[model samples]
Target: MPIKAQMEQLQRVTSLSVALEWVTGCPDLAGRDTVLKLIGEEVSTTIQGVIYSAESKGGGGAEMA
Candidate 1:
């Protein structure tokens, strides 16, 4: 399949975790670097959100005024 079709299929069928796994396992996949970079950013953002939520609840962060 062409790159566009592969991407559309992924969007239609895979969740984020599954997509990441598929992309990692497919070394020859087109746009693999771009996909990995995007996935990394997504995971980083999710982690940041969780950290911020925890800190807001007094789990350890800057003092809340």
Candidate 2:
């Protein structure tokens, strides 16, 4: 499947702990901090993308005063 399709599939999935476990099992990381940092960055980027898309489509809610 294409990356877009894979991402859409991921969006439909809700078991984050399972996903986190799979990601952390990758051999290339070789360290806890590296896995943690990469996960943190990816999560931050995903959240930012969601926020940006929502704002661009005028679906984002108003900020509190």
Candidate 3:
């Protein structure tokens, strides 16, 4: 599945193992951790994009304003 679709599906699942199963089709713990970490980094980057965009639009935090 596409990464975005996988992420959306994973977001709906409760258990990490279940999410990983959907991601990789196996119960590979180490690989799952790595994938999860990558997902986290991607999420962090996306959040940063939003924050930067907001700052550029003069909608950032109190300190910036």
Candidate 4:
């Protein structure tokens, strides 16, 4: 997928794991190492963000956006 399209998708997806699973299982995307690597990096970054947000939530009032 093109970067423009990817950016659009990034705005909508709520779960990187599920997106990764879908990408990995995609017939058109099979055997593409670069795409897999990009997906992994995205997932890792997203997970870190979630972890930090959870840990730093103030006054128990913070919720996922």
Candidate 5:
């Protein structure tokens, strides 16, 4: 599957294991690296609350936001 389509599938799934499975099942190492990079960027943005800034709760004693 194309990486974009694979990533869409990964987003629809709720489990990290399932996402990992998608990555591992990729036939091309370069494709896996690209997908992993995208995932990492998404994860980092989520962790920093940059993706959810509109709903940010003002840190609330947490490091996010």
Candidate 6:
């Protein structure tokens, strides 16, 4: 499959949790699966860090008048 298809399916079929679970299930995965897993982890970790910082900072800098 192509990267285009993978991105589309990411929203529809696997979801982040399912992809992470798939990654954990295999230690020697390769190809598209590895690419998808890497992307997922990268996004997940980044989002987590953002949320943590926001909580620590209180209102996360999103305050509105």
Clashes of each: 0, 0, 0, 0, 0, 0
Looking at model 6, residue 21 earns an lDDT score of 62
RMSD of 3: 8.3
Scored by Cα lDDT, where does model 5 land?
Answer: 0.59
Report the Cα lDDT for residue 37, model 1: 83
**Which portions of model 6 miss their true places by more than 4 Å?**
1-30, 59-65
**What value does the lDDT take at residue 26 in candidate 5?**
92
Candidate 6 lDDT by residue in tens digits, 6-60: 4554454446656666666665657657767676776666556555655555665
Model 6 lDDT vs. the true structure?
Answer: 0.57
Per-residue CA lDDT of model 1 for 26-62, tens digit only, reads 7666689889888777766655665566576665756
What 10-residue stretch in candidate 5 is worst by lDDT? 50-59
Question: Worst ten-residue run, lDDT, model 6?
Answer: 1-10
Clashing pairs in 1: none
Using TM-score as the measure, which candidate wins? 1
TM-score of each: 0.56, 0.51, 0.52, 0.46, 0.49, 0.45
Order of candidates by TM-score, top first? Answer: 1, 3, 2, 5, 4, 6
Q: Which stretches of model 5 miss by more than 4 angstroms?
A: 1-17, 50-65
**Which numbered prediction scores highest in lDDT against the true structure?**
1
lDDT of 2 at 53: 55
Q: Which one wins by TM-score: 3 or 4?
A: 3
For model 1, state the Cα shift of residue 55 in Å.
0.7
Better of 1 and 5 by lDDT: 1
lDDT of 4 by residue, 1-65 (tens): 34454455555345655666666766764455666787678866755554554556643425544
Which ten contiguous residues of candidate 4 have the minimum total lDDT?
Answer: 56-65
TM-score of 6: 0.45
Q: What is the C-alpha lDDT profile of model 2 across 1-47, one tens digit per residue?
A: 34474466457343443567777677776675676676667666665
- Candidate-wise lDDT, in order: 0.64, 0.58, 0.58, 0.58, 0.59, 0.57
